[model samples]
Target chain A: MPLRTLLQADDVRRAITRMAHELVEHDPDADRLLLLGIPTRGAVLARRLAAEVARIAGREVPVGVLDVTLYRDDLGTQPTRATGRTDVPADVDGATVVLVDDVLFSGRTVRAALDAVTALGRPAVVRLAVLVDRGHRELPIRPDSVGRNLPSAKSERVRVLLTETDGRDEVTIE
Target chain B: MSDHLLSTRDLSRDAAVALLDVAEDMADTQRRTVKKLPTLRGTTVVNLFFEDSTRTRISFEAAAKRLSADVITFSAKGSSVSKGESLQDTAQTLQAMGADGIVIRHQASGAAAVLATSGWTRAAVVNAGDGTHEHPTQALLDAFTIRKRRFGAGSRGRDLAGLDVVIVGDVLHSRVARSNVWLLTTLGATVRLVAPPTLLPTHIESWPVEAGTDLDAAIADGPDVVMMLRVQRERMTEAFFPSAREYAALYGLSAARADRLRADALVMHPGPMNRGLEIAGSVADSPRSTVLEQVENGIAVRMAVLYDVLAGERTA
Candidate 1:
């Protein structure tokens, strides 16, 4: 009996590579481009995207991590995900900020990311990019670029596991 | 102990001092050209504030940002929490969402303590402030402030050993006093509690500290430090003391009373100070005062606290 693979490791790579090229093509001037990874799994995805963007764009873009755990209203008052901090590199002024994350559901994470990004500095324009867009829009948030649009029930949990941290590269609905 | 920092009593003397020392490193961020770090690089920190507080919320926000952690600021003003959702439901929600750390300020004193015990969120729990129970970071910052003013910033990596200190005023309702008593006692500081008979906890004698109701003598004893606590008017309707003016005239750190202490002694109060109540403005702003130092050290103490709880650095 074989194990299940929701979105395999290879599948994630191919989609993000295409997403990276689209990002470069859309922005053109890659100099002002910086990659920000939301914590836990989003950080890994952002690092991958930065690597892919480097191969395609012939440049190693500055990458930063945003941990927006402190902004979630659900913690203690209800249920909440694990949270960290927001780390933007020194040179975000007048740059195009592409915030990256693994999953987009309820759009709260993106909303928090926007709040975190705003605190960093004035990025010329901010963009949202995600690996999976599990459509359950509780807020008016839409990603500028998305890897896969997967539908999930509000009761179900969608977890993104990476080999770097989770010992496997896959997304599972558990 | 689990990785959560729910209170100061949970920390050992070495652990508490290490946290303060790490905070010393975090304080250097203020002197940096770029006031940020990637130390907590891929971590998420959630600020779940059930209570409204501006200075503390903003200070934690600034501290988290300086450490480069993702911060989600959640205030349940008109949110789902107002819908009467259970605390378990809320914590599980954050768990499902993947929160790494949760900084919560609730109206309940043991709320943070309960959350840390509950298997709700796998994230590290840092209590920002809780209902009249304990504010560990505030106490730590108070200690840090005292240390810096008495010894200077270069006195980093030091512990509060052999410091004789007396905390007067309202101890029964002060979370700050509770935290200080625990941490300072652990750090080998000989602590004495001076309060009105009604203002001191009955079980306070269980702790390893001297307790009394004589304020002038506590100061007259020439202790190395005198800490006056604010009389929470809202928390008390009936008089804990006879009158505000009388409390000042009798127990307050007036200029003449202030002159009774050792010339090198320190005076402290955890402000929002009442000018003529527990502390006089002149005494609060005096040369020996560490009130302002407490406010500034609050940032570093909070930074040290957050970093200690979330740094993933541990030793047996």
Candidate 2:
């Protein structure tokens, strides 16, 4: 299929709600749980997730944007990319940090995000969360919470569209 | 962005804005507790300074180090250049030692342009400052500071359009003023230069600025920014002006002149300030002054320039 909608708007909403509930269940205290979203679509998803978690746990969780462009390993080999805003709301010292992203592919972005987080401050724990996890393991990285795991070949392209950024909310593969 | 940053005139509007935007991001990284990035790891940058500028050299070295690049500062005072070593021999030596980038500040005009265009080395070239030619990074940092003050947090992707800026003092020997004139006008800001008649360049009519000898008129116009350029006392071999007191009275941003400016108008000086000659001591240390901010932003702007030139592979 040239274009196929894997997750509709309602499905994406439900996935975020479920992930927020799972996060609340994991950290009921909700004291040191911080959600950091990667830039672009991931930052939007992070805001939505933080709001949901606040509603469920009856406490607001700190949310920040983590742009890993400068920490990437391929900067020297590939074209230099524009950096995004890396705003850590509060200190990450001794806090449980969760990196939120839209899609996880080669795992390199997450690797870079990890490097960026360590540079910011030493966190007590670190976890990964993604809306979609396509199977293409270039590095030893696995998500702690995945909204959907879609098995696809390396040649296919996966896209995550958020209403805040792309005027819609859905997951597509082509 | 080009491989070398020789002049702001070479940068289009979009390219200049992009550089400023990147500098904003670099400034954000600098505010963090850990201010180092691994973007330029394993890359070697040689600060090839032919003139004695400790501040600019330190700023470039700090920018390089913050990006995790190894920096080798080569000052010409005691180096091989003092022994009459030519630029070609020095560049060849740097190339043989595998220099990835060279930030050069020379005493002759077009020195940076020649080094960049010539085939002495394959490294990226950045002109720190040339003989009254252009200091591109200094202009970039000044633009960065102006945009930040004008737009505040909403500074990214924004140009200094519709802003009126008045630059006062020695225009003949100011590379900072030259670079700022070209870059700021390109960014859509209106620039006015005020200096003594002798200090103003003879080709002032050809530039895209309003040049005048009346600092009072420029200040009375209620410009949004008033930038006082440092009067180069050392470069004044002949009589550029009658006396320091006369120059200060005619052109300095004195208390009366500062009082005439708009309350919110920014006061800027690319310093090593002649506290009483070009700008009053109280004016330089005023709340509206951005001298220290300009210095702080210099590292960020230089980091952006270094990253732009050195991060990507050379594309000849």
Candidate 3:
């Protein structure tokens, strides 16, 4: 049950800023872009990313929360957790959707999120963005925008704490 | 979490509250353009009814479908059950066909309990309504509606502490009343059961509720919710009440009785109502009536129940 701080508050801020710049560079059209955060910390990270995007592009990007709990494939296999709210602000039809998450591990979460997003509406393109990519991906999915690529053992758990929910901004390993 | 929702008595305070909170999330899903969830996509849910029902059956069906589960509806009439096939045989057949969940409504009390405890089926058993024993889902939805009406969006993680609820009409044959009395009380609501002597159950003293024969007296208490149970005329082969007109005069939620209620007091009905028999048409359709809300919440509540029983971790 030991906890060690992996990324400090300043590191998270800098990583987000860099990711925002990369997103702007990759896609100049901010109007057709929508950032949907996976629930829990993913949602908080999405809001932060949206703010960062607004700061860089000077245009507000629509952000929504996508709960992948119900869309998960391993529902009954692993004890199913309660589902969070899925709120998509705009019609996703023909829009580039960047699925945001705090951590990227097995890629199963992103896969579930993709299913959830597609069920909402047919997007022109769907992209993946993560604050941290900790490898050990069981699925063939990769993040387009990654804040950090911290390789670690599969036995270890990466915990991302945000000020919105956890009252602190830091990444930890336990 | 239990694997089956057979009775409200099996629900702990925390479990009951958790189910309600999950239902709130389900309700939130209803507002979205894509109301379907992928949670139960590969899962199969069978609506197994050994009795006739419209609302409860449809509510469970809608709930299962919304969760993206394949739903197969089985009615007793025109089915193998009408050919004198037993409940165990039918349940085993469903199990063999790979049903992950069974939402059952039966004419006999304790049928759901038997299906849940017996090893005939491995699927999670959700009692839509089992005779007059209990309709746990109905009570859950009723509680959800009441909590939503009283607390609005702040109802999450909240219990009905210090709330007053009065259940009226044919208590002798009402699974809704039995379930509500147990669940509402468990959620910290003080319940008062009002029915005529003939309509009230003989063993009412054992129930965890204040029992009374005077509807006016109970209404005078200004309860937070007034739930009217349907008067099953078909069930009453012998005269339970002297006449429908006399019952309406004494116990029916007339417009006058509705006016006597506090402005905040909500009216409820487990429907297929005998309009003028147990409740007045005006009162049933009144602004305070959560009748329609109950029907709507029924889907969300059943979804929560199905989720908790089938997908949730078995903690107990």
The models' CA-based lDDT, in order, is 0.79, 0.91, 0.89
Give per-residue CA lDDT, model 1, range B1-316, as digits (tens): 2367778888788777666666665565455445665546677888988888777887888888777789898887887899998788888988887788899988889999788878787778888778888888888887777677667756566778889899988898888899999988888899999888988898986888999988877877778889988888877867787788878876788988898889999998887789888888888888998877777777777766666566643221
Q: Which model is ahead, 2 or 3, in terms of lDDT?
A: 2
Off by over 4 Å in 1: A1-174, B313-316
Clashing residue pairs in candidate 3 (N, C-alpha, C atoms within 3 angstroms)? A70-B39
> Taking the tens digit of each residue's C-alpha lDDT, what string does model 2 give over B5-81?
99989899999999999999999998776899999999999999999898899999999999999999999998999
TM-score of 2: 0.97
Which whole-number lDDT from 0 to 100 does residue A35 have in model 2? 95
Give the alpha carbon lDDT tens digit for every residue of A1-174 in model 1. 233457988987778888898899889875789899988888888888989989998988888887765444333333222234345665767889999999999988788677666656688989988988889889998998888888877877887888888997787775
TM-score of every model versus the real structure: 0.63, 0.97, 0.93
Model 3, range A39-102, lDDT digits (tens) per residue? Answer: 8888988899999999999989999999888777777766658767677788899998999999
Candidate closest to the true structure, highest TM-score: 2
Candidate 2, residue A72: lDDT:
89
Clashing pairs in 2: none
| Least accurate 10 contiguous residues by lDDT in model 3 chain B | B307-316
* lDDT tens digits, residue span A46-137, model 2: 89999999898888789999999889898877556777778889888888999999999999999999999998889988988899999898
